[model samples]
Target: MSALRTTGLRAATGVAASALALAAFAVAPASAADTTQASVQGQSQQTAAKTQQAKKQRVFKVRTEKQLRMAVRKANKTSGKDRIVLLRSIKFATGKNSKGGAGRGDLDVRGSLVVMGRGKSINAKGVDRVFDVRTGSRLVIKRLRLRNGAPAETESGGLIRSRGDVQVRKSSLLESTVTGAGASGGAVMNDGGMLRIVESRVRRNSSERAGGGIEASGGTTVIARSRLTGNTTGAVPGNGGALHLTGTGSVKVKGSLVANNTAGAEGGGLWNSATGDFTVERTTIRDNTAAGAEADQGGGGLYNDGGVLTVRASNIETNSATGAAGSGGGVLNNLGTLALSTTEVQGNSAPRAGGGIEANGGTTTVVASTIEGNSTGAAPGNGGGLHLTGAGKVTVDTTKVLANTAVEGGGLWNAAAGTMTITGSTISGNTASGAAADQGGGGVYSDGTTSITSTTIDANKATGAAGSGGGALNNLGSLAISGSAITNNAANRAGGGIEANVGSTKVMLTTLQGNNAGTAPGNGGGLHLTGAGKVEVGQSKVHDNTAVEGGGLWNSATGTMTVTDTHLRGNVATGAAADQGGGAIYDDGGALTVSGSTIENNKATGAAGSGGGVLSLGGTLELNGTNLNGNSAPRAGGAIEVNAGTADLADVNAVDNATGAAPGNGGALHITGAGTVTWANGRIAGNSATNEGGGLWNSATGTLTATGITFEANTAPEGPDAYNDGGVMTVNGAVILPGSGI
Candidate 1:
């Protein structure tokens, strides 16, 4: 060949290689794409010429084990793709064993060969492996069965061991095993080679190490339209009962089923090592188990260890991780990147955290997926649907996490070092039920930095006696939520919609409605803050919530709460004690500031209920540009109350408040028991009391100071506009209605 002609040919080959490299990612699994390309390109010229000369393919017929062995020996000397047709079943004896070469323990093929079994079988007779394909060779088996090979003390592969390219079509590999230390691949092992299993079945295979059915390393492995079932691995701290992959390779599984596989350690169905890439599409992995003896071994269906694993349009269900502290009943990703698209993960269980999935480190993305019906079946279990921890970053978009159960964080959990971003998702029908007082988060729990947007959280329950946060909880971290809905959730104690405990929480453009915290001493039917937890609410709605105290919101002793441009309406407080009612807001010894907000149509029922709209119980209450209207109470302080606390009102409106009981007092504003009320630029109008002090009432130990305040349309039998029972009431720039005076 001329030099110019050779250069042209090399250019053409480069173009073809580029095209093939691009096609590999789209057409095959990441692991199996380039497996045989290099071998095909590196073929010797003599081998190519011989392949051309044997284009018709020399055929050898074999009906017995001796004839088959003879044909293999003859074919090894030839340099072409020859065919050996099996006319009948052949059972190999234990005597035909060799460490190397064709005349020894295993049938070793050193040339390109094809075995056409024609639906026949090759039984190993409890001896060695069936075939050994050497390097730089190719072997293809079709319509055959390889069974009952017990390879003792071998490195891997009970049925076949290949160092070249091997393909099995429409075949079965059954009852094969590889035992002892460092052994793997009970059926097939490909070392630095390419393997393809198409339209096949691999069943009842066992391995002592990894890959009870198949193991591929340093190359590509592809499995399509096949089934792997009833396989087991006694991998003392091993992985992959069905398929194991490692060493910078890629494995693709499409249109297949992996079921009923059991692993002694991780990955009952499939395992991907740190340098490998694994992808599953249009497949099912079900009824797999990882029953390891150690605490950190899990991933009943699939495990990705520092690898890139992608699952699309697949189902992983009915898997169990039943070990001490074992997690990720369906999938476990340890320091790896995992992506799930349009997949379903359901009916999985774990003894500890992450009943469905656990992302311990690295990044995990779930898009258009469903995770449901999973549980953690032990005390102190958490994250029934998904758990993210240890600096892991997770993103959930347009996914659903539902019907999962745990002692804490029934739907999902994010630990202190994790970060989660959720958008356009739904978390519902989950339960957090435990006897511990502080264990509760029915929909989600985050002790990390979390952001939720355009999500829905409803119909979740915290059913324990002291449970809280039916919708979501943020403890010891920062949580920001916007454009979400939290409704129809119930908590046995407090925070039917959301709870912030020792954390920073912000809610914007959200709706919280129809939630109930109805148990006795229940607080904050819509939101609760305790123990120095700071909260901010803007442009949100809190409505139709029921609680014993703070029907809409409760701010505990040491927290700071700020509300702006929000609405609190249709809330109810059913407690009968004077210290237990705040229909819209209760500042229980906390600094609460409300600005540009609306508090309306809230009620405090029961005989002793007080403060239908706002209550300051030994706390600082500051209001600016806020409206409190149409609030009713049966006892005292129909709109605003101060109980040994300080209230500062600026540009506020209190209107149409009523005390319906016969001896009710202060229909709009009340101060009692060493309380002080300072009103600046506010209006109190259309308020009615059944007895005395229709608009303002001050007790003996209380002090009322007013500037630029107006009281209008107040009606009562005595002290209609202002009443001071041995209390100091200093008024400047105050206007009284035509019917009453102070």
Candidate 2:
């Protein structure tokens, strides 16, 4: 032939060597939009080859175990990779010889085989397994039912055992049992092989040790659209009633259900260990129980040890850890990482701590999740919703923590040096109640550093005689809160919002409102500070707080308290008077500084009440660039009652302070006991009194030194502006209005 004719003929026939070389260049080229042009043609050729392979496929029909074994052996001798075994009703009976699904007693595949059952089932009748894959073999089984395969005397895998690889679809494994020494995997066991299950059921299985449904080791397993129900593992110290994985294997479960499973130790549904990784999506794990006898056993739904677990769009509900000291009813994460997105954990319970989740030593992250309706069973149990400890970091973003109950920390407890961050979350409607004392923090308890931002904590309660109550938080470590709201919390004793013990607190751009402390006599309705704890408030609000003493704040610390750009208003101090009443603040032995703040519209309404704004007792109180106005008292010192303290007031406003309709003294400034009050460059105006000393009153043993002070429009029935009775008062550079002096 001519050369031109030869080239044209080679191009016409697509199997030419030069044409195939050009096909490689056209496959997945960069800078090309028609990406699948060569791949589509190549796939067509591969499909033609597969069609030819299908011509070699053969089918065998069997009705008994002996016939199935002969067929499998014949298929292995001939076309082992392309043979199908069709099953009918095989009523395999119980035999006297004790051989469990091995050698010639079962349908053992020595090579690749396909099992297809068209409306047929296999009744093992407590004899042997229906299908078993040997070493170096592959199996595919579909549309089948396997039942009543019970193995005895330390042998595992009552129904199916795979030493190679398997792919199962639309099948059922039911009523299987493995009871002996260390017997496990009542339904299926994969030993160093890959497994894939689709649209299958594993039910009513029991194991003497672990994994009542499935167990996998040293391989990869994937299960989708499957169901596992009514399975149990042992009666004591057995784990993973549904599934278990060990060694360096991994599992992924999607669109599955694991329900009504029970375990005696931990992981009633699933367990993963030995550096395995697990991922679950769109699944449900519900109504499981872990009923151990003693402590250190938990995880009614799932557990991970020394591994990583990730879940998305899942639900864990109605699980329980019913032992004496069990914990983590929903999930137990020990030395592992847990990441959840859009998950819900509800109606779970534990006997000890962490009714919803417990994390130890590894990081846990929750994004847009809900944790609700969980509870710790009784006393000596804390953290009803969640617990974290031991050098782990927990991050919760846009989550809801609600309606949980415990002895302490009804919502969450971060204990022993863990770090936690909550952002854009809501924690509400939680209750903390113990039998007696030593219970507090209805919302959260932190023994480490806690950071909160843009969060809401409301409608929480801490009752039953807490020693020093913290209805929202009891912080023993550093706490930082910004752009948050703390409202409608109640405490039985004190500190309805926050209590800081031996830690520092920093709050900025936050609100503390509508909180109550104690029924009749309490302290620090908004906040309390004791021990070596310090507080700093900037750009914050403390309002509508009710207490018996220190309605807004109480500081009994020897440390420093700094307030800047803050507001304290609409607070009340009520009930009897023995040392009770400071409508805004009661300072006791602290270096207190207030600057750029407003203290207004507060009241001290008790009998013999004092200091409508502040009661200074043995502290260094300094006010700079502050406003104290419109405060009312029933008895004495409508604005400030100095019992025993030293105060320096500079650039401050003491205005509209009144002792309305009461026989009291010092509508603006009053000093009793051994204390010195020094006022510099301030305005004290529009004060009214029903009895004596409308503006300034100085008693015996009280010293007043005034400079650049102004007193205007103050009225009284007895003293108009100033009443000095046997007290040392020295005034310099003072400005008195024309009709405002006494």
- The lDDT of each candidate is 0.84, 0.76
Among these predicted structures, which one has the highest lDDT? 1
Q: Following a full C-alpha superposition, what root-mean-square deviation does model 1 have from the true structure?
A: 10.0
Q: Which clashing pairs does model 2 show?
A: none
What is the Å distance of residue 46 in model 2 from its true position? Answer: 8.2
| Candidate 1 structure quality by residue, lDDT tens digits, 1-742 | 0011111122335767665333221111112212333246767787666445544345666676766777788778877567888878889874634464666567898999899889999999767888898998899999999998776585689899999999999999999999888788999998979999999999999888889899887688999999999898995656898998867999999999999998889999999999889999999999999886454568999989889999999999989888888888999888899999999999998888888998887889999999999998763588899888689999989999999998888998888999999999999999988545466789988889999999999999888788888888887888899999999888888888887887999999999898887573588898888689899989999999888888898998898999999999999888788776789988899999999999999988867888899877899999999999999888888898788889898998889998877358888887768999888888889988887788887777787878887889988777777777667676664543322346
User: How do the predictions measure up, each by TM-score?
Assistant: 0.91, 0.88
Summarize candidate 2's per-residue lDDT along 87-148 as a digit string, tens digits.
Answer: 45666754722454333445667677777766567777877655677888888878887788
Off by over 4 Å in 1: 1-52, 293-295, 731-742
Q: Candidate 2: lDDT over CA atoms? A: 0.76
**lDDT accuracy of residue 393 in candidate 1:** 97
